[model samples]
Target: MSQELHPNGALNQANELSSMHGAELTERYNKSLLGVFGTPSRVLVRGAGCHVWDADGNRYLDLLGGIAVNTLGHANPLLTSVITSQLATLGHVSNFFSTPTQIALAEKLLEISAAPAGSKVFFTNSGTEANEAALKLTRRNVGTEQTPRTKVIALEHSFHGRTLGALSLTYKHKYREPFAPLPDNVSWIPAGDIQALREAVDETVAAVFIEPIQGEAGVRELETEYLRAAREITQAAGALLVFDEVQTGMGRTGQFFASAPVLPDVMTLAKGLGGGFPIGAMIVFGEENTSWLTPGDHGTTFGGNPVACAAGLAVIHTIENEKLLEHVRETGDWLRAALAELDGISAVRGRGLLTAFELQTAVAPKFVSAALDAGFIVNATDEHTIRLAPPLIITREQLETFLAAVPQLLTAAV
Candidate 1:
């Protein structure tokens, strides 16, 4: 038998990885990596456009889009070119300094967000970090020590992030319980309950966090009226309103922001921000809200690095240049309509490319497995809910392939 390879030995054999099949790679993965994410379903080798191939040479349509992060899809020429060019010139700099690419990206974000004068941005490397920074901003709104505004409001069925601070605001027990005694005083009101919100916000509240479309909760959308009421309620009570658009921001929801016009005092973004590159940001609206965080209050080492910012800029420019926003709206409508007519679908919900469909029976897991076997990548958010946040660059013909297979997949699942 061949000698067992140590973890470091495996790392040294990186060149040989391409030759390893899925089973061998998976077995090695289980031995060397932490089990938090469990076993990965496939050993994806490479990708182009909306398609990826496994180590065993299986080609699959990637419908999950790296959980909605690959805004321009895989191997996007523009995104790749910008990132490489920036890296060749100036890849990273200390937070004590900033690059032109970083500054331009922040400016573009403010503009697309329609943020008012004196708005500012804090950069981070992922969605959880963005939410962490926003949480700190809310804490800055603390009143006098005697009557500190410590209470935070988040909707039931909401998901913020897994980090300690962001996790405090998340509602699921399974996610929150093990990390017992999270930042205290976070209240969860039923989503879309205006009266409950009215009762929850008060002078002692620091902030209210909302996700316009709750992606993890099966793409449940909070009505526009409720969003408006949230704005009103938070403003009246002197509590900052925060929109966690980590999954719905960028061009994922057709519009740049899902709750556009109904703006929030603070907005957190990630996922699609840098196409496939990792980047995140927290936008503080208006001069007053922007002043809440000073230089020493927060910072990140690789947050505003030139290459990531360059990637972000390319994503925005491409989205605009290609008129993807309009395409997303049109395509999303077509996909949802088509999904609704599928045999096993019970209901479809979402706006733009961020969508979820409920099954008539609890077969989402089985259906997802069948989908994987049939050369498609999809996500089962729960027993009956399957979410689809395909790459913004995915075409109708690409989506149709999965659509055509759904009937057979559903039957196989049952």
Candidate 2:
């Protein structure tokens, strides 16, 4: 009988369990965890900067950046310090009492939003919760009117979140049909069609939710002109324009808010807001008390926990002090140009660090698998589109490494 050897050589039972590889963890996961996400591609153990190591000790360049949640990359020192310190000092307080951390983060979000003076914020635990808040706020904005606005218009191929209310606003039928009877009066129109938007947004609508860049829908971008039209049409009809910036906010798009050009009346942000810590926020701008949600109308127990807020403040501070916005702009441009020139790439489009490319051959998953085998992480948004949202702090040298491997990776898939 042959003894099974560990990756490092010796294999005692204790050593084997201690050094459990990706396959072993995956098997355990199958028995104990829900299968909602299907089989995860890897059982990663640790991450640093733009790189992650799986249980098998294989290191891969992380281009997905925790699905765009890791703004400062994995295990960022500055963000970790803030989180640890805040947790040690004051980790969480119920919504009954306000904390400076919450107020400071809200003020920061408002500033980044470039909202008016009296603009207010509502915090949540995730993007879905933030969108939920937006939905409720939209409904509440119809202050004591004879006929309250009840309709919501969202763009087709858009993704808001998975909650009951947010799912109603989402455009994917597959995700919505399973949980039917979602909050009523939601309609969808093809994105980037100004005419469609003009027709759909009417006086009966409470809000029109749009993703400045539809990250999940293959990183599709809604044109600035289309957004402007939405704003104009929604405003004229007294409908609030809600921009779901969950994937595009927090310096992912160079600008602090992707809705900066269109200036949406309301915006929901999360993903990288806490630089890997979980936190989400909804900003309601426009005339001061015009759209404010009354107290007790919307609330969250752990929405603005001090630790998360501290982590968020650290993320913003690092972006400013380290000048990551400018870095994203420069690195993203170089990457887009490089990807466009790649042998298998057909088209490249996105803003700042959030980007995607169309493959000449419709085999994005194949390419993704090949990239993984070659020690790189990338996402296949669809059969033909591969999305890249590497950390905002990903360096030029690290990008060069991935760029150098592109042709071979694509060739393997081909």
Best by TM-score: 1
Q: Model 1, 414: alpha-carbon shift in Å?
A: 1.1
Please state every model's RMSD to the true fold in angstroms.
3.7, 5.2
Over 195-225, each residue of candidate 1 has an lDDT whose tens digit, in order, gives 9999999989999999999999999999999
| lDDT of candidate 1 at residue 206, scale 0 to 100 | 97
- Candidate 1 segments whose C-alpha is farther than 4 A from its true place: 1-12
True-structure lDDT of candidate 2: 0.87
After superposing candidate 2 on the true structure, give the runs of residues whose Cα lies further than 4 Å from its correct spot. Answer: 1-18, 143-148, 287-292
- Each candidate's clash count: 0, 0
User: What is the TM-score of candidate 2?
Assistant: 0.93
